[model samples]
Target chain A: MAGDAGSIPELDQKKYDADEQVKIICLGDSAVGKSKLMERFLMDEYRPQQLSTYALTLYKHTATVGNKTVAVDFWDTAGQERFQSMHPSYYHKAHACIMVFDVQRKITYKNLANWYKELREYRPEVPCCVVANKIDADLKVTQRSFNFGKKQGLPFYFVSAADGTNVVKMFREMIKRAVDYKQNPGDFMDEVMQELENFDLEKKEDNSEADEDGLKAESPDLV
Target chain B: MSFEAKRCGVQFSPPSIVLIYEHKETKTIRKRIIPVRNFSKYSDYSMAAERLKNHPRHRDYLEGVSQSQLEKLHIILRDHMQGFSLERSLASFNLDPDEDLNKLDDEELARKKGQMDELFEKNRRHKDDPDFVYDLEMDFSKTTQEKCSWDEESDDGF
Candidate 1:
């Protein structure tokens, strides 16, 4: 028994040495305060206005979850309607998602289904949180938003990006969930892993010549 | 899924070469991919090759590459580097002599100048004030009406 225990792989030790990385993506319709919410959480300051993101915006943050230091990569997408049809490569290796909808605009709320559909297609089992942003403006659609969250079986939060309400708590919860997902990855993540395997196989077939270099250079456009 | 819905209509090509080089200071192995398309520009190829060669830590990686492979890569790079200029020469070979090359009228040019000035002023204001907020009252009113029909058909309008 002692010999067998000694031969067991030290997975936890390896994970601790290699700081875990988690990719969190923010998705929503245009003008739904996705950028504002991210900026407020990252900077801890209320940005009254934000420029519409054209491409992907990355925010790297390190946080201590449990006993491990996890590096969180937050990908904020351009909420413009034209950019809604995102490339599949954007969803590769994502751990979690925060889908936001504006409380004031009913259109933004209705567009949640479309955004969720896109996320599910690429990463079916990744944990997602529904955020109803700009709650400082109005509360009329509160019940409807709550119902939507319940229907999706996702954790929901009524956040005010302008007032810095519940932003920290929401992000903390996201980090915790991401850490849990990474540690076990259970049956839910099986499909995601299989899809990733298929993608890797396709990538290998595409770059047979470059295999000798042992360096995989990603395009700036993909980044 | 339907055929139209299943297809994204976008094709992406993978990078050609992966260069594994050690960092001079950290001694950490860094992987960089050099795409075939980037070789089209002579300056881009020269700069990339020069940086890789000058780095002290990349000596071992460069030395490990076979002489034949290196020569092959150089030939491909040279072809790509010259390809752009060759295409440019071919494009200008048959120029339409009767076409109106300069088409802008004086009034149109002045209007464009006014638009540019307005954009410059707006940009200056944005630069000066970090907390500048755009007037969203009209947009709010338009989007928040009881029967607000969100325009889902046209993506370019916003």
Candidate 2:
């Protein structure tokens, strides 16, 4: 059990009608091999697209959330662009996040605090799963505990994107929590983000319709 | 049971061919995103386009599209992968009909060749084509002479 990470509602964020889409974002230091983990999660059901506009990739996955199976869209980044600081806009419209780090590298683990600091800037209330990736390399680390996730009250998981360890299981739980938090976003969510601004669900064309479909509008040069 | 290709474009970030189409019967517009896998800057655009056009899951949706059009999209994606600027890649497609391809560099020539192939296919009379003429004749003489500059003034590539 992730230990009563909180289900009680406090603030009312934008609520979705049943079976609405969920946008999940993933961020971490560029330790390499996260794609292997994505493959583990997507299996043959996915085709990873390297987006050109930014240092990110969008993946399409379907997960069972409650009775109806809902579509979950993930926006994440990898490669050399990750060596630079990730743009804050990466968190825009994100319902939840899966923060991953290479367990073999203590520094990647330590850097989570810095990442979390920036993450709080935009999303302070979304449910985040602190994932230590590449545990297959060192089995002993799975037995160890990390204070970062515990101190922040975030759920923690030791996963192996290489061996498919807890990858699926961890995502399933994250998806459900994301849906719940999106509807309520109250007490269960960290209260810091609620005060920042109105949970504006603007159907504005500022990439709103495009974000819904992850498809670019017709304006981009298509030569 | 027919579809019209409304628009065609390529997403360079996560390299994929995005097609906007209209379902002929219902008049509903739909988009299909076909991810390009295992391709690099140096990949063969023809092979990649052929594979995608023949892919079972995609072939039906791609039925109305010509192979050369898909090849053009692949070339643009390849340009992006090869780190060429968008302006340069797009310029390669606005081929000058009067320009001599023989004098072009390899990369530029390939792009021009691709355009020529598409044009030729569009005009070629297939034996199975409904209006296929046994001996086709055409008059393509220009009716007017036009002046042109270095192309710095306009976009028509004239």
| TM-score of every candidate | 0.44, 0.47
What are the per-residue Cα lDDT tens digits for candidate 2 across B27-121?
99999888999899889988999999999988888876777778888999998988899899988876553443334544565565466445344
Assess the local accuracy of residue B20 in candidate 2 as a C-alpha lDDT between 0 and 100.
96
For A107-197, candidate 1 gives per-residue lDDT tens digits of: 6666677777666555556788888777555544333324454544688787766655676778888888877776655644454454445
Model 2, residue A34: distance off in Å is 2.6
Worst window of 10 by summed lDDT in candidate 1 chain B: B1-10
Could you tell me the lDDT of residue B60 within candidate 2? 80
Q: Per-residue lDDT for A154 in model 2?
A: 80
lDDT of 1 by residue, B18-135 (tens): 5665556665666655444454434333344555444565435554333323333433345444553434422332223232212333322222223322222222222124663432
Residue ranges of candidate 2 with Cα displaced over 4 Å: A1-19, A80-83, A189-223, B1-158
DockQ values of all predictions:
0.02, 0.01
